[model samples]
Target: MFARSLGWIVLLGLTLQSVQARDYRYSDAHLHYVDFFQESEGMDALLKAMDQARIDQSMISGVAVAKKWHEDEPKRPRYYAGDDADAYWYSATDIYVAAALEKLEPRQRQRFHPFLTGFNPVDKNAVAHIERMLELYPGLWQGIGEVFTRHDDLTALTSGDTPRANNEAMTRIYHLAAEQDLPVLIHSNITSKRERNPLYLAEIEEPLRNHPHTRFIWAHAGSSMEIHRHQTRLDFLLPTLSRLLESYPNLYIDLSWSVLQPYLLDEQGKPRAQWLALVKRFPERFMLGSDVVGRFDSLSEQLHGFDPFLDALPADVAQKVARDNFLAVLPKQR
Candidate 1:
């Protein structure tokens, strides 16, 4: 009788362990295929990282601007913000992304969704460039942007009139995105570091209101690492995001690594109640991303950082934010 009891106890222990183990799968919605120099670690490395991270799918795009190594600077800058050298719009970035995808097998290629981000957002001809790319790729391109506009320091460093989401050029692009059913991911900051309010809210709001048919994933919910470093936290961010989510049904949020602190998770790494409630309210409108550019060794770490926040959410809501939401927002027919 004691031997029989031991066997049942061991079986129950194994069942409990299975129940306790969390299966964490993710869809990285805001990944960059290359770095500031317009270079990548290649598709092989990216795929290996994805498999280890359990990233079933990813939205890949090239950086809009390429960092220049000016003659004045003796040493090359390691990153875009490393030196005062200006970055330029490199249309060839899209070509690099396409070539990388072509090298992959059909099944491997299907795992990645590529976005075109090589055009200057402020130029009228930018729309034509996008149209030409769509023709050249013929169904290879899945979306547009990570379009740099009104970004903190990058605005001053980029070699062009600063782009605005509501400008005429972007307006035309929005119409094209709507017609093509492509989602556009934009990095238009909500406000400058010095401002306590939503100083630059209109830049994004105008597009959201004007282009209702176009799906827009507001990168890091309009926050960046530079903004966070200066302010520690945007006191107005939660309320501002809540209002926008309610007002614009088409606006989606990208919860990348930058927005993790002082917003999603608190200083101590615990999930904040307000953000949790906000995400739960619009679970289908929020998704997680690594936002890792070029090198991806930290891909798993960047994504798994959301575990605490995900654990706080209801299982179904967490699932949507973790993997389902991004896939849902992709071009429906694609």
Candidate 2:
């Protein structure tokens, strides 16, 4: 009877520990207030979701580019990203995001870290628009991006000149970001979906090399949902990321959901040793993000996905990845 009772006590203790681990409040480093089509569930729904998930803060941005919907087609494409037509500059996206932030009560507003994403990265004159927005809003804008450059599917459908992270236009924007002490979250895909290798490394690498002062948050660590659909898994991601982290002090990674599969977790849904060791070695460099678009209902599950990985980490390191690391990269004024 004493042995059985001791076993029950131990079981209860373990359960309580798991509950405690789940209770850690999160800071979402990557989130979108709208989608390519400009649809959203709006601010109230988002705040309620955040409260439910215990997400203390979030880095929110508008979808940088707009999707083109073809009116004449018999079967209309649901989103412009995959459609045959091209998407164009969507400068008003920033305004939509800013207006949502303004609608919030002061207490509610404090939880958001808004980043500007409406301007064209490939437009040389885009910097002037950003300056106007920053001047108009003053301290309201916290950062820049998920700047969509070299995105799969979206890249093909985008009109005018294809944007690259290393372009002269983007170079000017990086300079502006450094001047304002704002971190830029760029979504430059590491490789094309058709190719299994890191063929597009130069698009992201060139910018990182040039902009040492500007803190660059490599969105989804250069991986995306489209990449996964084509290749069963990315064999090159782990080594590429590890080497980049070692090479660039200004580079931080947004370990969003796309990166979780085949990298952070094994096929059996267990944490991978290579990933854990890499994160542990650089605890301060990694941040958690849901990368959820236009909706808040999935917020909790997205944040909870990190729990297993967190459990394997030491308490301090887990806490850092879950919260501190994201907050650390935000603009100092906040």
Candidate 3:
């Protein structure tokens, strides 16, 4: 499959004489811009890599990446890891989400996604706490998800068997987006995992299906982090994403970190061409993302930067993947 893809890629590159001209601000539609938790620290890592990749711009923001944390620790102290509701989580999420949009509702409308884990501040006033964040910062947060979910062992002992938060929050979040004509990005369960059930996704899906006008983008190819142990990755991910895409039109995907060699391989050690083919078939639904953390110096020469990947694309196709498609529907500024 690699040989076949390489042949097509080379031929595509050769045929496109204006590939260089296609090089411009490749607005990555999805980005974990700020490391509120300092856990993944993926925000800063992404920016540096973007510069190295020569990706001029991105629609990056802080995400509520704590679905697993909450489920894993449903008792005692909630662990809201990775900066969602906390003031010090990241620099500014409210600003980015409401940067250009006009009008934001008070309380429920402007609330941040709750991320309770072992150390969470308790549901004693979870919604109120998030409301306080919106009241104080205003326009910093958007919604939640890109929320982490996995089948790791330590978490297995703790995570919940049902959706954590109230459907009200999901409804309100959806209402807020509807009122403002915006989209919500959620972390849905794409891959089949008996150990980790993305029950919260049902909550999210309920609201999304009800409100047809509301748009939503499922991140990381609809497959969040998983305990690979020795399992085939794509064997599970591709079919899952493919099914979801087939199921929902409002549902979109961002090809964030899959550009690397790791994502292309399945549990059977076979090269999965389905993902690349999906992008080729539906360029508008997928966005380009380089999930490299830290700087380009982190991985020099052999891989170079994000450019070779973007550069390798057929010019017009790359442009669509880069920004145009996303910006077409996303809220953009100069």
Best by TM-score: 1
Ranking by lDDT: 1, 2, 3
Residues 248-279 of candidate 2: C-alpha lDDT, one tens digit per residue:
98999999998888678888889999999999
lDDT values for all models: 0.93, 0.89, 0.46
The per-residue C-alpha lDDT of model 3 at residue 325 equals 63
Per-candidate TM-scores read 0.94, 0.93, 0.57
Name the TM-score of candidate 1.
0.94
Cα deviation of 219 in candidate 3 (Å)?
Answer: 1.3
| Candidate 1 worst ten-residue window by lDDT | 16-25
RMSD of 1: 3.2
Report lDDT (Cα) of residue 13, candidate 2.
97
Q: CA lDDT of 203 in candidate 3?
A: 42
Error of model 1, residue 88, in angstroms: 0.6
For candidate 1, lDDT tens digit of each residue in 97-171? 999999999999999999999999999999999999999999998889899998888899999798899999999
Best by lDDT: 1
